[model samples]
Target chain A: MGATPTAAVLDAGNLQQLLDILQKQNYQTVGPTVRDNAVVYEHIQSVEDLPRGWTDEQTNGRYRLTHGKGKKFFGYVHGPNSWKKFLYPPARQLYAADRMKHRFDVVAPEPSGIKPALIGVRACELAAIMVQDRVLMDGEYIDPEYKARRQNAVIVAVNCTRAGGTCFCASMNTGPRVQEGYDILLTEVVDSHGHYFTVETASEKGRAIAAQLATSPASEEQLAAARQAVDKAARQMGRTLDLTDLKDSLYRGFDSIHWEKVAGRCLTCGNCTMVCPTCFCVNVEDTTALTGEQAFRIRRWDSCFTVDFSYIHGGSIRATDYSRYRQWLLHKLAYWQDQFGVVGCVGCGRCITWCPVGIDITEEARAVKG
Target chain B: MASKKKPTLAVWKFASCDGCQLSLLDCEDELLAVADVVQIANFPEASRAVKRGPYDISLVEGSITTPHDAERIHKIRRMSKTLVVIGACATAGGIQALRNFTDVRRYVSAVYAHPEYIETLNKSTPIADHVFVDFELRGCPINKYHLIEVINAYLNGRKPNIPSYSVCMECKRKGNVCVMVATGVPCLGPVTQAGCGAICPSFNRGCYSCFGPKETPNTEALAGWLHALDQRPDEIVRAFRGFNAYAEPFRKQSEAYEK
Candidate 1:
């Protein structure tokens, strides 16, 4: 609202119309659709691919699909997947090599040009993307592949009308509404009567799309609906995290008993990180065959839960689950604040919802802080 | 016969889950390039090309659980110019470090096929305990980027830009919400090092001490906070006695609970 431009909205039918315009403009329309068991963001050439009649019921660290009241394009929280898988592909071929006559020359992998238009981008995810952008793009050692993918992207944000059970965006001040970092923002309004989505454009690209497509200036009534919908979503959050006096507890509670309680229960399965949109730790591997004729290096997701995640030459510094669990929480809450000048999470709640043990961050925070 | 010119990179095994050494192979993009630069000396997991060591860089995985491993590491040190320990087990005895608290012999007899044939130590120690290390890269399984950095550093004749600071540094850099203060979640971020890039918090979970204690980490204060959360002192002691329990600060902290 300060230096960023004001919000704008298109009518309910603007979603389908927006798709038509993007298709015509030669942009790949990508948004949330039901894939696997949970909702995930994927490419859609038409409106048919959208999860037209799907909604979610969320609780503290739990989420499940409930029947949709009506046909709606966007009606979900941050899904099991985020924009990361496309922007930063899980596995990438860095280079290829061939051995000829006892002499070898390795060729760097070429960039694959893939421009994606990301619709239904959430506030928190956008923030996460920015964080990644800072790491991958802004740094001196830029990832050429990531740079190519991210620069060719279009952003369509959705004002959250339904916060998930594990959501604490209000506490983190990252969501329940699309604040910024998008070309367009939409708020879906559904009542006893019918359903319509109010869309707002925020960027130059967004304005061009709205101008090209036939659309009305969002009415005051439609604006009220958008506001009301976002309010409902904010109020619907299933859990809340208390950040008060957090730094002191993290600093003071080095040998807390709560860690043992958590460790006893934690499978250290690392599921929480794998499913998390922001969890970016990766382990490197080199795959080779029996003949040693060929090979390719790869990177896979790794987690701290595994005893192997924290090994050192002399030995692992944190040997038990209690210390491992403690390290994870303390870094997330206390140390992140100290180092980054920013809190480490946007309260998307993916980790809470996806954890196999259903361990709640809120519960652990209280245990350590109380 | 053609003269052997390539520097041999031998990956070894110890008492770990094989995840750490796998981290080296996980460098899918860099593997062949690294192989081209160095010979595949002795890696049982990847290839049959088991050239005997006297290797340039010996990447050892797992921990020293048996007398055989203890003796073998000495041989490896002799055969290797650079011995780099990979993963939790090799670095700090691994989850098997959990056995450090209870009786190893009794647990062995209770779980194994034949305790009579199984010869093991009362404590599981790291590779460094048995041999002099060129470098000790940290992680539950070391981050591939950091691993590459270390390799690159060795090649360039410099200290790897590995941070000794805790996971808190990474969480801050990633802009993750602090799981502890913001969510009141308990975490070990204050003590554990930064190789993990603050992953648990990125997912909205707390830091576990997967990377082990940082330099002069003020864990005592954080431990007091966990105690105030209504946890018992025994549990507090167990918190410190984790994957790197044999390591100093965590060992001392864990022992304090017993006292």
Candidate 2:
């Protein structure tokens, strides 16, 4: 995609230069920063703003941040924020209406003019964006807001060297190493010589940014080290979900007693769907002003676990917790394949770690297969 | 339809903190808009101008803790076309339902100057326990947005779009790290319904289950995990016995743990 060679070495000190180049090009740089005791995405102006010397410890129903050995900017695994927040926001006003007597005028929200350079994106997140692209951008009814934001985004994908306690991206075949869907790919390498990043340009825009930065041809040894780092991350996965004939098994196991067992501990809280990078369920709200002269139609994120999500004229379809849990699991693991040509889960483990009850999806999938 | 008429709305209170009813007033931006569409017929908290019943919609807050309130809910149910129970109080008996686990006579004597003056039922129960509830909005104090949606949906002849998901979803969407995981704090977010916008977790505190159990909460599993985390059985029992203590799953769990 670019004229320059695929690989180049960037000094750790010059990481700030890359941020400078993006800012100079009128792109708002969004990267990880320490907030609320966890690393979360936020606007950044310098490399210092990045989550340096901070790493996260994650387990089923738990997540904790810890200090790392050295000044490692990208040492932490994925936090709660996915690129979805920037693209499809939590709450958005579709249009506002103004009424004069019986006549009405509707005004749509203005398009966001700022281009965003997403820094420190992981491989699993890149896959998640692709899934969302299919749902929002490539669908029959394209969401103009999502399309505009996506078009203006520049992806800076980071290859993981360490896996969090709840991560299973390797099992999903969507992460640990970024193979595509990035403007520039970065692998942090710390050697006897010094700390640096082996950066690869995958797009023409990335190449332009690379040319402006202070970089040198990556030595074969540095490239090998970068490759080794990603391989280590793959080996360190916390869990794995087997996808062998998973769709058929999930469909067949609709009445399995296992569902009841899972439901026994499953709080039908839609946490899993909310944290899911690819989950795109939404509900719309219509509001009018007291004067009856103005109104607004707002769209916000919704989950299938809610009875209202399944409610109809008579009553709710999925009345029991067992049925709701079954719907979510089946939709994510099986039905998502039919709809998106891929499983909805990216195996980032936000669902497992953030779940108040610590219900593990991998464990459930395994039990269902059995 | 010959010239549509504005729907008459009533807000009723029983044995509650009146927080849920206050939520309706809390809709500062939309209250004026709401008033334009619906006639506030019988809201004692909002207005002194009392309007008679046979209302189009009745939002019953609180629960039945007294015989008078128990009899009152049924009358209101007959008067209103649509009856929606708002908050943990009206949906699942409120925190006052803790009396259900103990002797109310002894409690009355201990708190009141004259036990004879306190005429009350032994058990505090949800409004639905007394009359057929058209809908139940779950929360300690119901989310104002849900209240608006319920009124709007009823007026438009459509189902209200309220989520039954867990707080974990909102917590993640808010970009809050897991309080249970990060701080080893016990949280009811997994079992609790989504409505409070995961407020506790965003503030770095565990969920207190103010919205009640979601579609199906695995309280047993969570209790087991909490036990493994070294939490006492009494502590676990206390967790479930908060806002919606009388809610079935939580009630059973707390009863099982009670010594």
Candidate 3:
């Protein structure tokens, strides 16, 4: 439709123009912002809202933001909140109804007006989004709300130049560099020459937005530097989950003693599932006004670690913590592939960093494989 | 519809603070709507008017700390169609259950001028221990919305949609950064129940376990982390021995750490 999408270089100072253009297109920009001592995704109006000169130190059961010398916009890795919060929200009202002369009138929720421009999306997070797209959109029972929000949203993916201590995106083959599934991809480069972003337009929409910005053809040297930064990140991966027969090992490791040991330490708090980018379980509930005149149906995110998550007619199927932990680990590594034709985990390491007891999934997988 | 008699509700109290009953009164706007659905037959906190026993719903707040109240609960249980114990006092014996771990007479002799005059039981106990409780709503002072939810569920003949999951779930849902993970703070959120909506962590403080131990809470595991965070074993013991001290999981965990 237009000049073929090409790689270009935009100075760091001009990045704010991209935000303005996205806003002009009526897309609310949501990106990483430091909140409650950790970086979290929320609505942002300006590029200043992005975490600058800050990198995160994340290990099992720990996370802290460390401000550095240089001003790197997407300096840190992804945090607890993911792009799913903008798409598959934590809680939402499905419908409302009111009694009217023996017949109840149903009221559907108003269509969402906020079309989010998700900024600073990492490769692993993009992979997580793709995994969720397969689960929510490509399934027989389509989630209409997810489908609508996803179609409306725009992605601005950022290739990782530095990996957190808990990150293993390299092992997952999902990150360190943006491979695919992005409208616009950016690789941050801060070198002796200057600070800038090597941008690559993957779609016509991305090219149209880039055409509005002040950009030049990225030099061969700048592109190489960007590539080197990503390669450095790949080598700096702090953890790794060996994928060789990972699903088969998990399937056969059902009764392993490791499950019991993990269960003993596991609080069954559901923190892992909540922080996970791809955990898409939810429970629906109905509430009536005390007057009994109105009723509402709401859905909130649920986790398998909860006792009620596996509740049946008599009692919960996964009554023991051992079984529950085993089920979650197996499902993430084993059953997910059987059902969806892809592994569930994206190796973003949110589960490891957010876990209060420091349960490393990689270590658990290795122990299970034994 | 006029032929349908509204369900009669009775609010009763025992030896404890009336904060849980105050929670019902705190439902200022919703109280009017609640009144329309059910008859506020005998709530001493709200009105002077008292109705006869055999109430449709008996909301019990507080714990049995004396022989008189212990006997009184059985009678109330016989009269109530559905007896729901509200708050930590009625559900887990409240903070007064600390006396359960030690002799009650020494404290009585120390506080009261005349020990003979004080009539009390050695062990404070929850209503469930003395009588059959239909439901036990957990919290130091029960969440009013949850109280309303329990009432509504009872009226609709459905199970109450109260979550027994950990407070971490609520903290995550609120998009809160983990205080324990980020800082080396000792938090009870991982082992504590979710009813309080993680108010403490949202305020950048650790949870106080006001909602008690969640379903399948691994207190041993949490204690180990607390120890690693520089909390002494006694401090960990004291952490579990709070408002919900007598709750089975907390009691056992505190006892284990006591040594």
Candidate 4:
């Protein structure tokens, strides 16, 4: 009653019941599932939908699903599909207009009011959702769609028990443990004690859901074991970025010669931007039907890597690949601090893993700031 | 609505398959809507109705593979107010441009019953090589949506919103796992232009680059990754030398790997 202290323990069976409770509460539960040889976020009806006994091996330009040591639900790291797909969406119709006899009547698509209970969200991904909140919801003009979706969402954070090959959240100070921005935080601990999750409710909504689930108060040992697992993952970080004077270094290294070197190998494919959970750049296209009867304005994801993303009247502002690549890197690392109060990158290492050529952002930051 | 005369649109073809021309006919949903805005002036494939040019918008398909086509492309250019070339055949010389690397006489003799009957040029070249093309839509069999976009853009007096970025952008947007990175498959999505909605990658296959070379495609870097993936030099060459083989970036890259 005081603060709902480290509420309860949910074993493997209780975990499945937790999913059922969320579903019964009219929350469309979405979690990680194996698809296309990767662990991706998708709509799940039950706990069976979670990627159990499967993990991933990630490195620069490489991601492969591998067998995990035990039956762990949140075993794998993030895939190409980020949580942004749920909140921001890859493509959305802004509005449409139908030409009448003399005037045009604008029509807005019916708002999808379904509540989403985001389960198994990683610590770094929680940071990404907050980063997007700053960009979209906490801006001069809030995005109505993102605002509605975020408001209706229940975030369930999962503390990492293992580190992926591309993980650097420990250095980013965003993950390996869920510090904040979650309704419910779960730490999966597996050993001779058997597989179980130590649940910590952070909000009233989370506490209400926890009360419905069949659970018992976690012991001091269980709490310590969960902490040790997260601590182990923190120590096993696959990569790291120095945050000391990082923004200042990036600003001073504006004309760094390393840009040219990285650009030589960069494909400008926009994969890094697309896979980044916080990137919110979008391009709008307005099209009038050849019949001149109907018109639509659609907004789709855009990246600075595209030649036309920086286009002006005469030609593209960022004509060369080096300039475009520089724009993306500087925006994510340096300018994002100036714009938003935080660095754009959450250090999930997705950019490194998904890149066809394996362009490491951490390595580039080091090279540029050298 | 009735008084204003609709601008005339023409579809022309030359030295390749009629696949691109079929794309216009395949726009079943938008075909009627398109007809409402533009008069089908001279689409021999769809209609025998031949209105005289200078046409308002000309969607030219295929390449210049004959002495006659080389001269005829110039005539089409002079007649077309806005010449938009619509497929790999019109923009990158198509697969038939493989003849540019070999003897066309051998091909003519191999395919034709009478070699003397075929009057062809030594090189199979894009329409742009022979005429002034206002815009070039690159694809093996053109994406019908892009064809519609090109027509709509021309009619509305705006630049066509065709992206010249790598197909990886589209593939990533579709939320597909990277075939090259994830599965160790050699994909050209990193170098190919965005069109066909990243079809090949979505199907779990590497891009064959039917959309041609993207704007400023870093083929050299892509080739390096392809090589590191254990792709042999010949395989790497073949990867670049697919449907868009004659495109400058693909051509140069393929030539670089050719022994």
What TM-score does each of the candidates earn? Answer: 0.59, 0.89, 0.98, 0.97
Q: Which digits, one per residue and each the tens of the lDDT, describe model 4 over residues A155-234? A: 99999989989989889999888888889888898877888999998888888888887778888899889889999998
Tens digit per residue, CA lDDT, model 1, A1-370: 3433343454555567888888777777888887534466778877777777687755433456655666667776666676877787766767655555787667678767877789888888887777667667876778788889888778877788777768888877777777777887777777543566666677788878767755556566767777888888888776777777877876777777888887765644454565556666665555433234454555545566545568678777777767877877776677767755556666787777655345777788778776
Task: Give the total clashing residue pairs for model 3.
Answer: 0
> How much lDDT does candidate 1 score?
0.71
Error of 1 at A89 (Å): 1.6
For model 1, residues B1-259, the per-residue Cα lDDT tens digits are 0244766688888888888878878999987767665677788898886776588888888888889888989998898898888777777777777777778988888989888988998888878888888888777878887777666656545556576655654554343444554344667876687788788878867777877877555466567766765558987787777777777677777877787
Query: Which is better, 2 or 4, measured by lDDT?
Result: 4
Cα misplacement distance, residue A9 of candidate 4 (Å):
0.2
lDDT for each residue of candidate 3 in B45-116, tens digit (9 for 90 to 100): 899999997899999999999989988998899999999999998889999999999999999999999999
Model 4, range B23-103, lDDT digits (tens) per residue? 999999888888888899899988787888898888889988888888888888898899999899889999988888779
Query: For candidate 4 chain B, which ten residues in a row score worst on lDDT?
Result: B152-161
lDDT of 1 at A312: 72
Between the candidate structures 3 and 4, which one is better when assessed by DockQ? 3
The CA lDDT at A87 in model 1 is: 80
Q: Which docking category, incorrect, acceptable, medium or high, applies to candidate 2? A: acceptable
User: How many residue pairs in model 1 have overlapping backbones?
Assistant: 87
Clashing pairs for model 3 are none
